[model samples]
Target: MEYLKRFLKSIGWIARGVDLLVAPLTIISGLSFRAMKFIGVKKFPINNSLFHKIGFFPIVNHYYEPQFDFKGYSQKIRHFEGIDFNAEAQLTLLHSFEYKQELDALPNVKSDGGGYFFNNGSFESGDAECYFSLIRKFKPKKIIEVGSGYSTLMAVEAIKLNRMEGEENMCTITCIEPYEMQWLSDIEVELLTQKVEDADLGLFEKLEAGDILFIDSSHIIRPEGDVLFEIFEILPRLRSGVLIHFHDIFTPLNYPEKWLKEEFRMWNEQYLLEAFLSHNAKFEVVLALSYLTIYHKQEVCDTFPVYAKDAGKTLGSFWIRRL
Candidate 1:
């Protein structure tokens, strides 16, 4: 009986290894066909150069102000210590993460309404910068990302840079998406075209501590409880020192004034982390930057103060750690 059990476990591992090897190629093949249909021809050439030049001239003054929340931004949330909110500090941090150069080179995607889209879909410039910085800092061995978009590209770039810099560990990525995007076909990430809650997380059984788990898929379609439940399912399987990033935490329900567009108002999605924190006392906030919040399993041990604009104002990102 013992031999039979061990043999069955070995078979499972072998099957997963085969999946890891072939999934990316299969996904890329399907995505290539899809891309031919959707992105083969452009309706109009998106002139990002002209638009970016205009972006230099601030047309709206209110954009510089701090965003307001339902608690009026004075809710006194706990934040990481020693964050400098000055312009110089912001520039320095962006430079440290190589985000400034990347942002400058990004192309602008034009929507049907004649508006420009940056950082793929959903993620803003701030979000991209933060994710890049985190990837560079931690060098997570396994990245389990639940969403497929520009962030996928950014993560791949970060991993490649890490390898170039002589990081001996090879980082592998697994992206879970119900609907795959064509641009991601260029990368070698394992693509799972299924709901995150339904996908087989046993693939992560080999991931040790300090791996990254990023969640940024559906915002409104699933109930908040369902989302939290899925998180609960995955959390216990992870190592304690692993980093988990959750996107769209700063939703309209909590922070109303921080919204850049009217579409955000209709998102009507709640941050599941808030509820997760309320019930479970295991994780702590590493940082909360504009729609993105990072967390980990451990006591807080950093002196970097969270950089907020002022009283009744929110910073683009802030860090919180577990107690």
Candidate 2:
């Protein structure tokens, strides 16, 4: 009987063209369970464990809309004891640096609904701003970013800010953009137009204690090449003091019922992190604020604040550093 109701409710959501078909099923199940109380059915007869494995539809329906929430933040993360990463402080680092002049110089698009958003390819304003914040805070001697886009510009601006402040380091930014987004080349960073795995990592020979490595490339190479190499192969080449950042560390809304799908294998950012954790190495999460995670060497993790703040935002990035 419960399955019949769930199936009918799922059809309703499916008929409505909603992305989360299971949402209606969960809602109907919850309501039916309550009504059963009057009829004296003390226990929920259906095996709902399977539905729970499908995705986060029930939580979204019962809680807030598909927006920022702690449920999203706490979903797939593995937290350790220490000072949580402070999202506000990290955001301040981005805000403190001057980017308005550069952002204003770029082209803008008037919104059909109301205000204007920039034409930069697929960059979320807050996300890009937070990336810039990391650059300002780390003040790394070298920044090697995979899958370059608007982040290249943020790195450039951060370096420019460092120079303006006379920080003495004079950071070098290198972008490995496989698609060769032409606009990114216009920036001041050293742009590599090849896939990340193919890029010459000879730059690592000169990598210093404060260098940073950012990974946001395709999870798996299309016809050939494995993206995991970016972590397994390239990471060993990097020295101990360097910081490693992984973007998109949470399951997407449309995640399939089975976790082992090829799409999940290729694009699910959490897979790579979990795989890395399985390896016998010391990697510490320094900052897990919003969707951005920054990690340093195990010894250095103790130095960072464990407190993370984003008010209420989640995009699922994680930080892991080799010890």
Candidate 3:
């Protein structure tokens, strides 16, 4: 019996020693996880030019601001330490990430109504600078945008400012919408070109590359969602130098309903991402205006369901050039 007691005591000591060793590692791992809660895991294959460079936290301004919920990957990244690898990750997590250059002024375009549409709000001076800068850099010959009315007006102003001329600086802008056309008296279009009924949109095949397309159709209807998906599928028709922009993402939330009465009138961002990604398009959220989303032909990912539970299919407002 005494020998058994000694054996038991030996086992207890060994167990205690093992716990002592394991505790610190376990605690360390737990702490690591907590740290990751704010940052997130470092991932490879950033997949998008906007997300590729690992520095300067893309869309970090309002992401971790604490006053509001960034939501999506940025929101998730703000909550974790490392694994939250989306654009929301701050410099603390990726101190080495590169901060890209931001454009400052419009090359040639000006807002017609005296205000630059930013974050769904009309912005002037510095606020509009970012929009102009985005226009200056993209230099799209073909422009496609989604949503309607106000956004279209703003885009018209941008196109006039950004369009460049070589032997012939030719550009075309297409806005896909189910609503009636509004007055574009603020901007000038040498030729209004042809009109495709909401049903005959299949004829967009002739747009070619270097043309821009915008999708601001309908944000509240399932058919509009389907239209967006169809447009994305036909992106191979775009010519080089194509530029596309998505409206409504200027609002923080991915859904159009989350927007205030004014914001509700615009398109949503979630659908834009889905259209781009599912069609293998590439794009970026211009820091000056996340609302001013950009796209080209590349391996983009689909993110349509990020906002609306009932979101139909992916639709986008970014530009694509046919290769």
Candidate 4:
């Protein structure tokens, strides 16, 4: 309490007119120092991982990143372990506010008379914010999102916000969601209010070149888990420059549970990443928050192996172990 009071007092002093003259300059100086330090810390860019169209923001999700020198930060990250706020803490209060902003903008349309929420299946406010911001930053001509709920609607919310702010030059977005629970009619209703047209039905099966994908679906199947990606094997058709996103890559929503123990297994990002590398490479984890994984295929490899049956199409699965 005393430390908080002191911090608050310090903030008040910073806000006061007496300090106001020096505050902005001092703040700028502090930011400059931090920027220098961040650059100084092993200055490794994701040049190798960036060839792919994927765009990730690691600072937002606070997910475990193999980079950021985990061994060094492990002590620091664990130092304030129990505190609500840590230097490593990714999402900010601003993220929560953004989520509410998305929620508030949504229209209450009912296909079956219940209040319906719309968003890309990524339902968390912060996760949605992370995705939407990446979309703006990446400016992908083709985009893909994996999991969604009302959060996909939040993306549409972001589109509305972008148009209101006038970003006509931004790239087109296509989100692949397997669950048909939301029903196209409700989605159409929601899009109608936003001046956004209906979603493309071909989103799940295939996409032409210059597209990106979000893999928020599932690594495993469950009664509760509707979308299954492990068995789906849908990564081949995406073009070389496609941006791929994976949600829940760091965390599990009660998987390996009583109901789905037979169907569940531990997931390793390394395995999945290596698998992705079979076809594409050059990547970096931009957002470490919410177990987020974003990668852009720098170039589609020649070894993506054409299936025996359909010589024109790629094989079903590319395993990290086999290749």
Candidate 5:
């Protein structure tokens, strides 16, 4: 079955590549498809896969219309009349950077040792710095990290520092991840080798005020997916004052244009988060790395001059507090 699925996916990719090669012909084919539909044509001699391969069918073919007006939704969010949470979150992030020296003292943060390291692929662009600093600043008693990897390493280092400072309440760290990463076994965290959707919902309910729920989700919102479960099921069940971290979230702006057109990354987690926070008062933004990197460039540069020079001007970590 796996091989069959792979074969079908390969065929689909080939069709899309062929369509891109004959781009002008696909536009004409799209117009013809629309005209045929208007004349009460039920089916075409060619399969629907040919029409699906056309990139502009969602715009050109009336029958293959978009489900939502994404542009209008984005504009509405830009002009939202609610409290300026992004601005407030920027201040929170700036304050967290006061612990920069302490974060630097951690042995495993950027080390090339057997333990975890940060600022590598996927965790760079200032997100790793923000994560380590926030964990050090907040000193969350309990940290339940979903989809863990590099962030888990940061959390472990921060907790070690907290414990070293004689904070007796430095509590347990739990990581829920389906994929096998052997390094997790060496750490102090309780690793649950399963998907977040399959894990017990009670785990999230155990999180109290001042605890942390760090989520690095799949970014897709399909039915029964991890992103949907986190947004709908887990988020509502958490206690007030819980700090929630979402990685790879670029809010108050769309995902980068290059990421969309060139890389073909169709991530929609931030869009769902934007709609959820629209005039909703239960949750308040605590930190938005992308928002700060874009709008508050000077402050970020001053705070982490090395990161600014190395990673360029983009970060994807976002934080919020459950009110």
Candidate 6:
């Protein structure tokens, strides 16, 4: 059965290559599909595989965007229906100013004297700064970061600073990453070299009110996928007041146009989050970094003059407190 599965997979790749080689023909078929829809055809007889083969996937995506209204979703959560997301962002912005000096003091791993290094890869824009600031401010007793990397380094630095200040209840950090980096191995935090979905579910249940559940997931949801497991199982089991951080979540807007058309990053984790938060009052928005960067551009620039140049752009680091 395994050999048959592999054989089929190889054949599938060959078929995909053939489809791409005849892309012009496929695109013509896609145009026909669009015409069929225009003629009031309720549904096409073809499935997604056929759509891909006929080069209609991108067209379908462009025309029939996700029904979830991301702008309205952001607006609803930002308003004070239960928690004032804007006010929380404002408060977080204020606290961020205090941490600049300390953040600037952390030794840069790649370079010297620039504080924590940030770029397009790993942690970048204001997300790195925001994570560092939040860790210092909240002082979570325990931090369980799911997809770890540069953020782990930042969190470790924050914990170190907390200990240096002689805080009695210093936070302990743990990282769960299946594909570990060389730098990740050197970090002092407890490392679980496995997927979060496969890790013991009880690890999340142990989290109390003042902990952090940091998630930088695969961003793709499938049957029995990690994103589904975390959303359905881990989130519901966490205690109230626990801080939750989701990476690459650009709310108030859908995934970037460039990402979809150019980069082809078909990430839908934000959509899942939108669905989860729609009518549920169990969670409250704390700080939406992308939302703040776009909507509260001036404030973000003022708060971190060092990152002022990148203030106009969006960064994907969202924080929510369990209610």
Tens-place lDDT digits, model 1, residues 108-144: 5645643224525465455555676677777878888
RMSD of 3: 22.8
Least accurate 10 contiguous residues by lDDT in model 6 = 68-77
Clashing pairs for model 6 are none
Computed on alpha carbons, the lDDT of every model, listed in order, comes to 0.53, 0.55, 0.39, 0.37, 0.74, 0.74
- Give per-residue CA lDDT, model 3, range 17-53, as digits (tens): 8888889997886565445444653532242333445
Name the 10 consecutive residues with the lowest summed lDDT in model 2: 299-308
How do the predictions measure up, each by TM-score?
Answer: 0.53, 0.54, 0.40, 0.38, 0.75, 0.73
Cα-based lDDT at residue 286, candidate 5: 85
TM-score of 5: 0.75
Superposed by TM-score, candidate 5 places the C-alpha of residue 178 at a distance from the truth, in angstroms, of: 0.7
Question: In candidate 2, what are the lDDT values of residues 210-234, reduced to their tens digit?
Answer: 6878778775433445366676678
Q: What TM-score, to 2 decimals, does candidate 4 have?
A: 0.38
The TM-score obtained by model 3 is 0.40
Across 1-323, the per-residue lDDT of candidate 5 in tens digits comes to 56876887778858877768889987887677667666644465353555565433323323364233233333212445663566865675585567656545544345546444544566653677777667767777889989888778767767777788886748798999878576787888899889899989999998888899999978888888999999999999999999999887777677765666557566888888878887878998888777777677777766654465664756788888899
Local lDDT at 267 for model 3:
39
In order of TM-score, best first, we have 5, 6, 2, 1, 3, 4
Q: Which regions in candidate 3 have their CA more than 4 angstroms from the true location?
A: 1-131, 162-167, 175-181, 185-187, 190-203, 208-210, 221-233, 236-241, 250-272, 275-323
RMSD for each of the candidates: 20.6, 13.0, 22.8, 22.2, 5.7, 7.1
Clashes of each: 16, 14, 56, 48, 0, 0
Ranked by lDDT from best down, the candidates are 6, 5, 2, 1, 3, 4
